[model samples]
Target: MASEILSTTDCETIVKNYLNRNDFEVMWYNLKPFFSEVNGFLGEHLLLLIDVKIKERTTTLRFFTKRFPFEHPMQSQYLNSMQGWQREIYFFETFLPNLERTLPGYSLDFVPRYLLGKPNDIIVFEDLTLRNFDLPRKPSLNLLDNQHICLAIKALAKYHAGSLAYEEYKSRELGKPYRLYSGEEELIKEPLIRKEEGFLGYDWFKAGVSGLRALINRVYKGEKPLEEVNAKFEILVEKALQLMFPHSNFRNVLAHGDLWAKNIMYQYEGDSSEPINVLLVDFQLQRYNVPIHDVLLFISLTTNRETKQKYFTFYLNYYYKEICNQLQSLNVSPEEVSMAYDEFLGSVTFIMPEIKIQGALQRLQQCGNKDFYTKLLGNKEEFIKFVFGDKTPFALELFDTDDNFRGLLTEAVEEVIESCLYPEIFREDCYRILEDTLGKSAYELKQYKTETIDEKEFLFKLEITVVIEKNEKEFKFLVQNKPLGFAKVIKKL
Candidate 1:
């Protein structure tokens, strides 16, 4: 075994944990262990390719295992400090079981069956490769393609729909709404938004930052680029961190939470480039949040520049339709599942900052994307300026040139404007309802959409007033806009 994370004894225990009592006898052999280069910091992913025999049947099994004991010191730090293993256990044992029961047989196959999982021990799963499933020929490039994006979206839709169905079921049958795996755990005391440590508090974010820094040093050898990238990254990272765990006012569903190329596998038919099946893996970061959180993360991290530009809206609508269909299958009403167009758009915009951060880091650490990055990053002269961060200076060219990068920024701005405008729309609808009830003489509501001095301020710059003169006395109401919600209503002469 090349990985020190799991020993021969650990392997034996994993096998024993999965075996049935009905088996007359069982034997395990050829415990060859290898590493998956694609994985990032849920500790080391040790894949054990072994041959197993039960009575007359002999079959080969591929077991995916994660153990901190044998991982590199830094990897161990990320895993232990973040408590990622416990999350995986809860996902496998608690979340999946509940979700599976809610899904019909047609959709249940999207998730790979796990053999066994335990805290502080190895988690084992059936290898999709044995079933002729494969990693994308070019994960970096393919993720940017329409085929892959659609496949991921469809699978995510099913997962989210199933979760929502389960939630509704619990509410009706159990007298309470169902909670997600994250809610089951008591450890998540602090919300990510309030954390002063920015996005660096979580182990995964720390690991990503470390990887990005390493990539910058490797590509451009100067302190200046490192400092520049870090400064820009810190701002984006903070925003990205918040988006990763959005406080969505809309309904929440179980997010895969760590959706990326390696965590999702696509199975194809007869050497076809198109995938017939998509399976989600690695639920260690699973959270209860907006379903769009997963959708945006998948699109941002995997889909290419042109694909994002062309199909981002199409993809969103397609997923919404799928959700509607899935919910109907579960007997949920269409009214309850009415598509939140604004919510999806806002989330897509929210995730724009993370697109570059995640994509750049994934590309840096990816094994097959060497030629891809080498082409996009630069020639010898440009490379020198990028590394040194001084002299002629090499700015990150991808943000300007890449279609996806520009699209993310554009969508982000649009989302911010919409976020500001939608409230006024909501208030208008509310006023109509109130006016119908009150039989008003005259009322006027005006809203201003003004950009602020501080770029991050999300509130609509507005001044609103309402006047009603009745019974020889005039009543006036006035209010100002605030991000947390409309400020307390004021009465004036």
Candidate 2:
């Protein structure tokens, strides 16, 4: 019914514009819904398959059209608030054209060819599926094998390199440094970072943090209380928020902010299962950030633990090398355009904890059974409330029953603890055999009360009380500490 609004003449005009030929007459045309409802949350998609006749010749044309979700006012409002539609339109219209011109022979095979775009209304692209490019046969969690992962990484490398090259060209032409989010162009400004009044506001982020906190509290309840870990998690949240902004000291490039399996398509060799090419779609969340931001997200969301462990270093090396090669091809020095391998590794290690949290939340939503949650709670909002609110019993039950869910959540927690939180204490030689020797020790945070010791001086004392269970029975030891320490706070102006 929605497709009825576009007449045959309209379709003919679109096809004519794309082909740059007015002689072709429309013979047949059909528009159908494209992907699933979950795939395009902020927009509607239509697959347009048309047959055109030119003189005595007949040819088929396939196009994918994405339009604003006008039917869903709330979603439209959200998109407008975040400039999602505008950013995507800029990508297809201005950004791609400039990139192609800057690096004239460089390969943009990873990007789908943009056909036409109407600002905040619709964008049409050559349907990549017609060229044998398709989504991986399985869901994101299980879809990408090592080959797919490598290809995706390589594609990302090229994309980042291309953007950097374009920036260099624009800077030279303008006689000044040119950055995408230079605060001059509203359309290219950063969208989601520190934005507190939209769908992805602080409340949404807090909800995700609350959900993770609940899971941590539930999982490590008895002897292994996570007071220190929880404290670190709060700090990590702040750090993660800061990381969303671009670091001036680091190598910043245009990153596909949402690079997951669903956003990628692979063109396989004829008949064989080997993929020879990759195409990245969806630029709504594109932003200027460190290269590792995209790399960490893609690897974390798409691959399993074993795949990551086995090929993590190889993938990193491959991406770095590819991007360096891409830079070299574009006449830019890799040393100047890209971060060194050791620096890249440091960036990866530093940012991985927050990425783990992001991966956990995204994977949970992707892999979760929405119908089951909605049916259980009467609606999707209620289900979100259940997770974000104090409903740890249900969470614990889900954790116990669902292997995939449990694995994803626990992996995030374990990674944070092992990599980010109290690494010095945990990694020490003295604690090497503590877990094996003590079996498991549980502790509860009885009191974590803070008092202002000197209001004028901005000095505070934190008192922590813990109850630890020693033996198998209820042999609890109440350790009520005095003041843990005096923290001096400097008020920032």
Candidate 3:
């Protein structure tokens, strides 16, 4: 509803201070707040969908805002040029009360309860938009259902078993809150993806993911400084010695890190042949990395094993049978449940195109192959010799010669190489771990063979460098041409 900078007597004194001590009240004629506009990059996230009554226990109060981190300005310069997404709602209210006191079969079945915010920029909660939960106004991933694959494999083994029981029983009460492709939230998502660049919309093809990226500036002119991607993610937390729990526990736990089935939510138990009550709302990107990077970015960008291989082989055998029934409900054996499903199928990454966005795959080749998205967007003879700004003036007759838009331009470059989802299982294990550790100089890491998110492990114009020098006593590693352990470093100096 356009945008109302809070009011209705400040939404009736923030819904009468959470309904004056609680039997629930707020109804303001089915309150609504759903907008993907204001040139979108997510702002006005005071989370609402209100309509509550209680006493009759007609529950619903998902008034989330946990918001208090503002300093704004954005609508796209590529995408999310940050402004602390309410610091991921204060890292899901300081990691959901330590994941509801460590998973009793974890259940957050649909956001509708979490409120507290006001000191300018309000906060509220629980409002599943007054239910009757519809979904199919363009739903995909074969509209999942086997009780939404047993509540998304019981919410991905109760979120990697409450991040393996909060990093094996509370490590400094769980830390490392989301976003990390080398942090400061990738310098505020990179100046709003360069101010929403070639802009792509039309509900950007919903979670069926036809969206794209690769807008490039050598991925914004040679990145190797946020103090070297946080000193190579702080050298994968000092070569996995211990205590660094969330770099997405590839060995077990932590990695909701933004999985996409459009951040899932479902209820349909009665009408849809029962049992699809799986619910998960965005935990503002819970990171660490690899639970197969949220199961192949939520089964290759939202859903299609040609359109549901039984909700992707029943949520990949419901996380290899709930990490073998949580190591037989923690009696633990069978070699620690086959080493936690072989580190959960070596945290699956054949390439990495989860739900599409390399500048929405070169703006769909700058709108249907304007010559390979103007040669992966370096710009083709001034995007086909100057026509400027929003790129049209018959966008070169959309690649003419009597066009039909040439077979949807080879079906949008075979779905932008199936959204980089299989570039031959990440061209031999993430290009031999990025040229055996960030070698081949300071930029130029290929293997992006597309069809969609480079079938999972990705690369292109990857400029990286790590020149170290010690002397008489310790450190020593010289000469760079290419191929070496990409700075996953931690020198302590």
* lDDT of every predicted structure (CA atoms): 0.53, 0.66, 0.39
lDDT head-to-head 1 vs 3, winner: 1
Per-residue error at 367 for model 3, in Å?
A: 14
Query: Residues 379-429, candidate 1, lDDT per residue (tens digit)?
Result: 544432332223111122433355443344333323222232333222322
| 1-493 per-residue lDDT for model 2 (tens digits) | 5345456776776787788878888888876788654447668888877889989999888899887888766557667777888888888778777788778797678888876666677777888877888877555444478888888999898998898888777878899887776656666555665636434444446666666677876656333347877887777777677777676656677788888877888897665567888899999988777788899889888876545644565677799899888888888876655466656655665555557667765665554455546464455455445533333455555677877777766765555554334322111111112222234323332323334545554343433343446422222111111121112123211
- TM for candidate 2 is 0.77
lDDT of each residue in 1-493, candidate 3, tens digit only: 3134444445445556656654456554233444342211233444554456667655544454433324332222112323234434554565556666654554444344554544325455544444534342233332343455455656676556555554444433355422223344431122212223353221222211212111111122332243343333223222221321323333434455444444565555345634345456545435554454556445444443323322443466567677556645644432432244434434443113322332223223323433444342354344322222233223334534424333333333333333333322332233333434544222222223222222232222222222323212222222111121121212111
TM-score winner among the candidates? 2
lDDT of 2 at 269: 62
For model 2, the local distance difference test gives 0.66
RMSD to the true structure for each prediction, in A, is: 12.0, 9.7, 20.0
- In model 2, the runs with Cα more than 4 Å from the true position are 2-13, 35-38, 56-60, 139-143, 174-176, 193-201, 221-224, 270-272, 370-400, 423-493
Which numbered prediction scores highest in lDDT against the true structure? 2
Q: Give me the runs in candidate 3 sitting further than 4 Å from their true place.
A: 1-95, 98-100, 103-345, 350-423, 427-430, 437-493
Higher TM-score: candidate 1 or 3? 1
